[model samples]
Target: MSNLAPSLTAARQLADEYPNHKVTLLLLTDFQLFDADINRVLTDIATFPGDVHAVVLGGTQVDGLMDERVQITKATYTDPPGTVARAIFASLVNHRPGARPI
Candidate 1:
């Protein structure tokens, strides 16, 4: 759901169809993801037309390789999905004014 245009398009459509529900997009930045391009990431966030939030944390990697990390079972802080679940819940409950993406 982090693929910028497609994601925002889908979320916007869903949100419009279901105005009673909260729609959010959680993006994880790093010490970077495997493809970790800070410029593109920032651009995507800035250009997004829907609710989006970010959590920057250390990424799990070894020698700049993803396969190695997967073999080692190392976890990114935002893995397991539940971590993101909690963040979404928190954001919904305590939203700061002007913090949402436009």
Candidate 2:
């Protein structure tokens, strides 16, 4: 919706923070549109030094991503949830390819 402007502005700030640095944006939101708004985020992120990964937790996606430099992943829920440690381990184990462990 029209609320995307603020999000885009925040994304720009996040992207411009470290010129030589790489960033992984994890968005834990209600849903994903895979629309122009998200495309804008991908576009801004594409200007970074290398490939950028955007993970959306607890979201629904209708379309596949089109950007080569930006990868989008969406995760949903099941069986309630787990402990923080378990979640962290799972996330690390299922971590995105082409990225190193933190």
Winning model by TM-score: 2
Q: Write the per-residue lDDT of candidate 1 for residues 1-102, one digit (tens) a residue.
A: 233445445655666787665555555534343334545544554544446555434543334332221112223655775665566555565445556522
Error of 1 at 66 (Å): 24
Model 1: worst 10 consecutive residues (lDDT sum)? 65-74
Q: Estimated TM-score per prediction?
A: 0.36, 0.46
lDDT by candidate, in order shown: 0.47, 0.49
Clashes of each: 0, 0
TM-score of 1: 0.36
1-102 per-residue lDDT for model 2 (tens digits): 222335556755876787665544433343344455676655554564444445545545624543565555555664345533344443454435665433
